[model samples]
Target chain A: MSADLLIELIGVGKSFPKVSRASDRLRALTSLLLGRSPGRVSNVLEGIDLTIHRGQSVGLIGENGAGKSTLLKVITGVYSASTGSVRRLGTIAPLLELGAGFHPEQSGRENLRTNALLLGMSPAELAASEADIIAFADIGDYIDEPVKHYSSGMVVRLGFAVIAALKPDLLITDEVLAVGDESFQKKCVRWMERYLADGGTLVLVSHSMYHIQKLCQHAIWLDRGRIRKQGDVFDVTQDYLAWHEKKSADTGIEHRLTANGEYAVLRFALNGDTGTLPIELPLGEDLLVDVELRGRDDRAPVFGIGFKRVDGTAVYGTGSEFERQPAKRLAHGHFAWRLRFPKPSLLPGTYVITAHALDPEGVRLFDDLPRTVIVRGRTPELGLVRLAHVWEDPT
Target chain B: MNLLISLLAHFVQREIRERFLGTVSGGAWLLIGPLLTLAAYLFVFAEVMKVRLHADAGDSFVVFLALGLWPWFAFSESILRGTTAIRQNAALIGKIALDRQLLVQAAVLSAFLIHGLGFVLVLIVLKLSGYALNLAGLPWVLLGLAGLALTAYGLALALAAAAVFLRDIESVLAQVLMLGMLLTPIFFPPSQIPARFAWFVSFNPLAVWIGCIRGGLLERGLPDASGLVLAGGVAIAALLIGRFVFRRAAPHFEDYL
Candidate 1:
């Protein structure tokens, strides 16, 4: 292995022995003693091939029970792989869970010493950083109390403080950021940013796409104990979110409607594509909606467009009638309108575009057509649309 | 190697502290408990039964029993605690990845360290009481105790690993150790047993260990070279078998635990 290669896994897999009954345990023990695989086993991960180089920040995104935690354990050597090989180099600090190595009966101070030593710090090294760790934790007087007496927030504070002081070559954290209060979470995020800037490697697992996009340069999506996709952070996370949107849309109520009555939509197209499939557009790109409606009695119908998130949250809506512009007359009973959003300021996610056709008065709804639009890009901003803003210098 | 040694030291310290954490008198009970047991044994055998040994003319029954009792406590207690070491720390084992053998070794080492200090205090008391002990044979007695400790550690390692798979080992071992103590001739000399059963004393490895220590302290002269050789062989064999079983079972402990 090269010195710069922090972790490497080739076709690695892990399985646990299934020993629900007393006889199964006996059989498993006997087989293990005799140098054989257990009689019955359940595989948690399969054919996982991953390589993480030094100074590389990677994010692991997956739903629950997708074997993300098991993969992390295998990388950290907590669980030996049942097949293939795993090789890791350098000092690794894994915050696998809350209070994992802590003794409930021991004081926080004592647990810190044990945990620091277990992370491969020498006695002298631990002594030097002891004060810095306590200060970072900032839990006065509670440090002397038993860990069982601490609140859950206090426990995570102490845990993160120890890891921060250690400054390991590689840091692996699993969903630990959600437990701390707002200030501490900010402190941890700032520390991690500095750590990464200083050439420290990181492998983070989180459900929040904002955090993943902010911290990681690469991402891997695991689905059903296998790597579904792995590549650039933007590409993989976008694909994962699109997959979730499609899944929920399948079980959601149908919105497609057949044309009926007067003022019905005769044809609709987004970006010149009239097909039923959703359209993918990059952020800050222009969106054009074209619709042709049928009007009775030769009166032009009003065309309106509405934008919403995949979860039915309205983002923006406007109609030609609101702007005092009438639809263009075409042939005998046909009317058409073209709506353009110049450089739409929408965040990266799936959104639905609904077109409405009304009578000339724009009071009664006549027809509705819905189409899906996926905005693709990577940004740490929250919410649906990016509001215009400017930050003035304090000086 | 340095890491392993440091980890072992930390675990041994924790094990000793855990033993007396909740007690009021704390460490004082270490010496006081053994002294009280000695007092009760003296009352029962020396006063009530009037037991005497034919092998030693000058030493009382209390002196003869004291020589063997403390070593037996160290040996038996080490096995008992070591057997439960893995099961007791299941929480730590399931979370952090470290050397599992250290847990068992720490338990055994702490037991011997505690009882060894008590054994030294007993020897000091015997010397101050005007007993004609062959103090020059102290090195041989120490060697005998070291051999017994090695044997106990070997058995502890094997039993501790097995106990992870078989919960019954802890309960069953208590009965077996009690029966073993009675069969080792700790209270009675080998000469008291019938001629037909004399072979039982000769075949018992613990009997050879107690005899070696008693010979050095009671002025029976240095232990015979053949008996020392026999004890050394058994200790080494037990250690090898214990290590073999422990290594095979260590990797699967997490699955079963």
Candidate 2:
């Protein structure tokens, strides 16, 4: 492990024993006493080969329970790998698990001392850097009080304060910047920018793609204990987000199909076509959703369509039942439902369009289908839906 | 090794200061708390129980009891604190890449040092009251404290490691130590034990250490040659074994947490 290479993990793997019951733990202990292998194991990380260089920031992007945290631990030397070798160079400051080293009974100043010294700082070094940490924390009188009395945000401030002051050669953090108020988070981002500019390396893991795409040059997408994809930040994060959208839509469709009631949704498509699931369209363009349903008998049913961000934040929803327009049966036991938006005016992002069949009153939902759509635009202004307006100047 | 010791010493200072941060008296309470315990024990054991060990050694039972039991108190306090040191500082263990033994050693040693402070003053007062004071015994006094400290660190390593994996060990250790006070000659003298069980006292590590110090303070000089050798051997052995157990257990500590 040379100094310039920072960190190297060659085919690293880690396994944890699966002990759920008291009897299982006892059996494991007995095997150890008998010098035999313990039963059942689950691998949390497998065959990961990654090399991070100095002054390069890499982001780990994946869905929840994707083993991102386990990889970070392996790199930080907290948990030894069960297979292969891990060699790391340069000093490391890990901002893993917020307030991880802070003792609630001790004051912030005291915790600062213990945490810094544990990070390998000498007493003289800590004393010299203490003022910078205190000023950055900005907790004032709370720095002297026991940390148990501190609010959650104050604890985050103190934690970030220590990491920021150190400016270590390699900074490995798992969502430490996600805490605090927005302005403080922004400040931490600015400080991180400066830190990276000074030729520091970073291994960052966060759920926010905006932060990852902005801060990291390279990204690795982990799935089920393996590297799903590794490439530029923009490509990897976009792939990860797109996968999330597809998975959610698949589940929603599965729910509608499994219900299999008298009324059932047969096919759902967007843009009057089926070329791709998330049909691409420009902003301020028309979006058409078509839903085919089969009813046990010829009865008018309410049809509704709604749109939401890929993350499940609602953008716009409308039901024909609200407009008191019941669908008419075009054929025996089969009805065609269509909703059209002449101009969506949606901001540029991935979105889900859900079409559902309901009773005439719209109180009871019988069957539903969901499909994802991608909106493209060149607008600089931010938000879910863009509204048409003309600017006027007062003279 | 130099770096490790300095880091250990740093943790010890933090442990000492953090122990009494909230109270108005702050660090002063460390001295006062042990002194009060001494006063309370002297009243109950000497005046109420009316027990005496070696008549040739001294006239005051409180003096004899204080001299013999101070080291044992150091041993007890250390194990009590050390047993839970790692579990109590899970935040520190998971976040920092520190030598885990350093945390246990610091907790145990700080407990010894604070109690050792009170014992040093008690020895001074005894000398002023004209109780056969000799500089030759000072070496034995130092040796006895070192033995107790080493033994405490060893026991702490095992107990703290065990407590992390098996949480019940903490409560079990507390109960065992409470009863262990009777096994050692703290409240009463070793002579009170029956002849059949007298070997238990001689073999008990804390009893052996107290005897070593007693030999130096009130006697001609030095403890029994064999007793000093035996006590030092146990202390060293415990330290070695404790280090092994701690090292093996340290890697999986995060998994348990």
Candidate 3:
């Protein structure tokens, strides 16, 4: 790690054991006695290596249960890793789990003292910053009222106001900005921007791609508690989204298992007559979809195929019934359902090809394939779904 | 020293505020506990059991018990509060960036301050009820507070550490306090006990400190020199042991909480 780096984590890993419902207390004790392990427990973070330079704003993006929050907490020392080391060069203000230190029964002023003290502010520091904290929280007479009486927004406002005033060397923020109203969210973002501009380091964990692109110069995508990709904000975010989209598509087909049973589309691909997978095509050329489906029963299924443009514009689809052809019987064996689209006029970008199978009674026998075809641009694109346009002007 | 004193000062003030705020009548009702306990003691011993001591030491036997009982109340409450001091504030201890040991000490200090104030009120009542104040025995009164403070401080740290791993310590300590009050020289002087069990009173730290206050404020003046010394020694030992436990438990606190 460079000397200028404000935070460094080397091979940092954390794991929590799965506590079975029947053996909760026993597992807790047994896990304690058995000691920590990499494989025996659920890894919330594994082999996390990152160096955050001073004044850098780093955004963390990942799917749900991707350990984004856990990584931030580890960086802030709210949680310690089971293995590896984290060396922090400056004071860290953990904005993770905001309003965590406030007492419910205590008045806002008293809670201010307690919270400030908890945050490592001295008595004098608290007293000096009291005016600014109160002004920012903006709960006039209610400052004397107990904190439990305050609304969720008021609590967040107070918490943010206190920390923003402190202006620590490093700020670790979780996805708590979503708690406040739109205006307050804007305020928080503005303050964060100012903090970064003033040479303060920030580690942010948010699910919002727009915020990550707008704020951070660098980003990390965590998947299954490990770094999947780390690079410039846009690149990592795009890759993460693409992977997320693929995962969702896989699950989308699986959800149809109630109707499809074990007979389902396993994979779908597109290729030319020579078996070359062309990403783009000449407007008059053919596009063939090779779909593989596995079946345990001889349902004598009739296949259906569709080629749709990226924007939900259906270019073409047909089944045996639609084509006025008799249905073919599918034996209890692996089979490929291939469909060709001739002179497909897909404009550019990506278009999806879906394949499914149905019985003669029109009931779905095997579900849809979980992949999309990319129809690249032969020329500079006008739109994703192309409609051949003819222009005639009379002057 | 300066930091310690300041931490203590703030803790004491906060404790006083919390106790008063927690009650319906605040400080006004603090007297109710001692007075009611005094009444019950007087009824049980003086009326129901018809027990009498040789010393005609006061206008009211109830006043004798109140003076001793109030201080012991402070000591016991301090120990009880100290037991959960760090555990109850697990959020503050685990998340906060302050000195971990100071948090436990603060709870001990708070309990001591409350009891100290209550101790003063009992003395004023004793003087008002015609018991003469021996100015010479004043050192022993201060010593009583010191003994209670040290013992409470030690127990606070130890219990704070133990409570992190074992939750049952809080309830166990409460039961210990109740049993301790009956065994100690709180309601009656240790001299009234039989010879064999007198050693039990001497062994119990609370008995030594509470007995010191009883002898100093009720008997005449100053506690026996050796007894006061033994009380101070036990208190010093408690403080040392408690400090060790607290420091050892500090690093694991974040994990457990």
Best by TM-score: 1
TM-score of structure candidate 2 = 0.78
**lDDT (Cα, tens digit) per residue for candidate 3, span A36-112:** 23124667899999989987888898888999877876787766677899988877887766777787877888877
Q: Would you list the C-alpha lDDT of every candidate in the order shown?
A: 0.84, 0.78, 0.70
Clashing pairs in 1: none
Task: Output the better candidate (1/2) by lDDT.
Answer: 1
Clashing residue pair totals per candidate (backbone < 3 A): 0, 0, 1
- Estimated TM-score for each candidate: 0.90, 0.78, 0.74
Cα miss at A17, model 2 (Å)? 3.9
RMSD of each: 3.1, 6.9, 8.3
Could you give candidate 1's per-residue lDDT for residues A54-125 as a string of tens digits? 998999998889999889888887677888899988888897685677888778988887888777887788
- Cα lDDT of model 2 by residue, A58-118, tens digit: 9998877889988888888877776789997877888777577788888888888877777
Q: Model 3: clashing residue pairs? A: A347-A386
Task: List residue ranges in candidate 1 displaced over 4 A.
Answer: A135-145, A175-190, A253-266, A292-304, A319-336, A356-369, A393-395, B44-52, B55-57, B194-197, B219-234
Worst 10-residue lDDT window, candidate 3 chain A:
A30-39
